[model samples]
Target: MSAATATPARTAPGATTLPVADPAATRRYAWQVLRAHRGGVAAAAVVLLAGAFAGLVPVWLVGRMVDAVASDAAPSRLWWSAAALVVALVGATALAAVARLLVARTFEHALADLRERTVHAALHAPAAHVDGAGTGDLVARVSGDVDVLRTTVSRVLPAVCGAGATILLTVGGLAGLDWRFAVAVLAAVPLQVWGVRTFGRRAGPVFRAERAAAAERTSRVLEAVAAADTIRALGTAETHVHGVEEVSHRAIDRTVAGMRVSLVLTHRLHAAELVALGAVLVAGYGLVGAGAVTVGAATTAALLVHRLFDPVGILLSQVDDLQRAQAALARVVGVLSVPAPAGADAGGAGAEGAGSPAGHATTVPDDRAAATVDVRGVSFAYDPDRPVLHDVDLRVEAGEVVALVGASGAGKSTLARLVTGTVTPTAGTVLVEGEPAGGPRASAAVAAVTQEVHVFAGTLADDLRLARPDADDARLRAALALVGADWVDDLPEGLRTAVGAGGLPLAPDRAQQVALARLALTDARVVVLDEATAEAGSDAARTLDAAARRVLAGRTALVVVHRLDQAARADRIVLLDAGRVVAAGTHDELLAGCEPYARLWSAWHRGRTS
Candidate 1:
């Protein structure tokens, strides 16, 4: 197992892991959430305090019954005390249930808001950052970390709050009976504090490591699963499997280490409880012997000290859980720290009616006629020392189909990404409708479909609605029909059939048809088809091309062509060689005037004929 396997995709060359919120930011956001539900918080606190007070009445009443037996008091008095103790226990139970409910109701509202904001931040995150971070990091935060925080808020948090209240009130009851008994209980504080401090210092880093290792394992697994076919084809399946195993082992080791630390803390807390109980017993015996207090008062003090056991244990045990919750909270909120794309609303609340859930909102109205693209002196580099495209310029007239042709690594897809606003140029400008590419205006006007299309897991209609949320079923069927997806009728429920991962799996060519259908539903005037037919088999290529043509009919299109025949059919072909446009013309003109084009055509013709 290599070190690289432990780090996974986040530490890949040129990749940057997404940011995590600092302690201060996490605390601030938590306070903001609590403040939003101040009414509920106040109500929960009052109910909990009342429950704690009621819980102590039983201990005091038991002490009174002991004194009555020693002094031979009236039987009626002992009976009344016993009756009151029963009533107090019942009252405590009812108040505790109500307090727990109030705490959950109050905090759940804040959790819902945080959940929404985290999702919005993820969807609107800058494309460049998301590309570098890998999907595993995002998936872990939204899924695993969110679940952890949700459990903490709904269950563990209320327990801690109620336990704390009980502990404080019980300690006060000891003081009211006799101040020396309260002082005796203070003997436990030193050991308890040491235990918490030691656990905090040791467990924080272990839990954090566990969370990170879990994310790394997820990344390795997803990478292997998504590229299963490619791994098998290249005979590198063993390597991927080993990578996943290494990350899994690391995660397991961290989890075990955290558990060991928690066990050590529990032992120390147990010792603290023993020491406090011994001190309280000695104090009660001394006060009763010297006549410093009555037998009833001493009995009350002893009972109060014993009652501290449950609440104190509960409070101390929750320390480990709180550490884990804190780490998870930082990761979930960290996504919100990533900046949204240029011209997007702060916190990813994009303008209303921005078609898709994550769509960038633009102030400019749609103008199909003005949708001409111009790339002037555009240069790009993923790394500063290695330039991919140098001083490349190209243009596409409104409603014209321009094909970008090049050998692999000649920057064909890179250039298409720049024109479609997936990436910004390192040196120059990419303009659509006279405004900068990747800005609000350009993003609103442009839509893109690549060979790597995703069919979301849902009813077919829900997946289609992502592009045009308000679109009716008739419009969805029309778009699907236009793209030649006649297979929908064969499904058991037509448009209501579930699709995508774990659902009915569609062939690659059929999935591309769904992509084209979505593109058709958008009002975008400019469309980019980057190797959209590259994954289609020879038998399905013609069908996909026809679908691509219909989708691009009235839109200005920039196609990254893989098949030479597709380039030949374009209105104009721009051939890039070694990051430069070496030739641009009609297919026949290029063959007549450019030797490179003639050679490429001859080679392609030979491959087909052979």
Candidate 2:
């Protein structure tokens, strides 16, 4: 069987092939996330310490009240002790509330900053890098994973810190008052700690699997929703639904398994606490009988042991939450680690000189744009051992229009990408002016409008401003008009009208118009239109073709024409067979000399006529 046929169907993005967690890696990721918010971490530490200190006051007050009662003090002393206890409890509660508020605020702000940074990193990454990563996974990292961090920093971590500190202080206080009772109260601590350590190791892997499953489920749901129309047309709605269900089921199973481990740990902790309480009671009674401790002291020890156990239980219970947060932190850190694309600033004497000729000035001119694009002995393969474009040699003059025409999958789009600085040739250099074309200036000089035009969520004015942020209203209108979008002015809000999702949805033709308008706004010296008008109907195509020709009146353009009529109007038509340019000349010259060109022209003409 062929390799493709032998392989099983692809699993959903974020699916885990193995359910093993690395505790060391998880700890490292958690530390990185915590360090990212130095200010928040500092605030959390301060809040936790203060809360722990406040919590200790109640235990101290309970001991003082017990001592007073056992001594059979006067009514005045007894009443004073009761009032002091009340005051301590009230003060502790107030301090805890303030600390909670401050910690929560700091954590939320830090999470917001991290989320923004991750998004910025993803946006600046190279297109090829982004294509390798799944959009759904990136989205989950920003939205869901960051949220988990917020919860951990704000709710779980502080509680764990405060509870642990409180337990330690309570134990110290008890030991100072009566050593035997204190020792008995902490006798089961070793067992409890051992159980926690054993289960904590398993918690990390189970939680990681659970998070991955949830991310896969989310990706599937998003795919199904986005392609609902295709699913309906292909009668594959049920299949997609089943895929979603499978992911959901796996997620539920992982979550339940993690929770089951957590429940066992909780039960063990509770049993340990009960055993410690029993030991404390037994030791307290024995000390009282031997006259080593007062009756009230023994009572106070039991009460204090019970109170300390609450925080201990709370600390143990939050281990699962901490594990989940660490898993999330790993995903977030992974996203932030993606390097951004390199580019040149608008600062060079040559670029400045070139700009001055056109009345366009920049603070810096890109030296790379001065280089010539030389694609000599170039070859490429998206997959190893399966070359697509091979040994291709092509060049264009400083001011020349080169139209590339070919059958489907002829590597035309890949060539355009090579020229636009999106991809580097595997075997040869793609130079811009003379330098290698892999920087911002080269990208700016060589602009491309692909078949799919992305319209961001914004007003019409906002969309136009993307091409030239400082462009005035007049410039925007002029560009729109140049793309034959004169009807834009007729909209109710004109330039202010919303244009993307949650706004007025533009038809495919109108979207193409917007893209062409953007190209005009860029005013780049070299423009590559890779089937930019493929989505437009025939009538709209003709109008757009005329606008395109007018827009390229004096500029260098590489037009990838699908229709022969459009190719006939280009300055030169270059026909490709396999990966090499087999014919290059005016349309009539190609039709007269090249059999492939003539057949393609005849077929396009018939299709257009029909």
lDDT of 2 by residue, 1-610 (tens): 0001111112434222211224454455446556776776677667666666666666666666777777877778767767877787787777667667766776677667768877875665444444434466667777888889888878886677778767877788788769887789878888798879988889878987788788778778888998999999999999999999998999999989998999989988988989999999999889989999877778778887888778988888888898788788766655555544455233111110011112245312322222235677777655445556878777776656778899988878777777766556667777666656656556556566776777768998888776667778998899888989988978889999998998888887788788778767664666678887764347887777877776666566677877777778787787777777687888889889999999998888788679
- Badly placed stretches (over 4 Å) of model 1 are 1-12, 346-367, 501-503, 577-580, 595-600
Provide the TM-score for each candidate, comma-separated. 0.90, 0.84
- Single out the weakest 10-residue window by summed lDDT for candidate 2: 1-10
lDDT of each: 0.82, 0.71
Query: After superposition on all CA atoms, how large is the RMSD of candidate 2?
Result: 6.2
Model 1: lowest-lDDT 10 consecutive positions: 1-10
Model 2 earns a TM-score of 0.84
Q: Pick the candidate with the highest lDDT.
A: 1
Cα error, residue 438 of model 1, in Å, equals 2.9
In model 1, residue pairs whose N, Cα or C atoms come closer than 3 Å (at least 3 residues apart or on different chains), thus clashing, are none
* Native-referenced Cα lDDT, model 1: 0.82
- Model 1, residue 301: displacement in angstroms? 3.1
Per-prediction count of colliding residue pairs?
0, 11
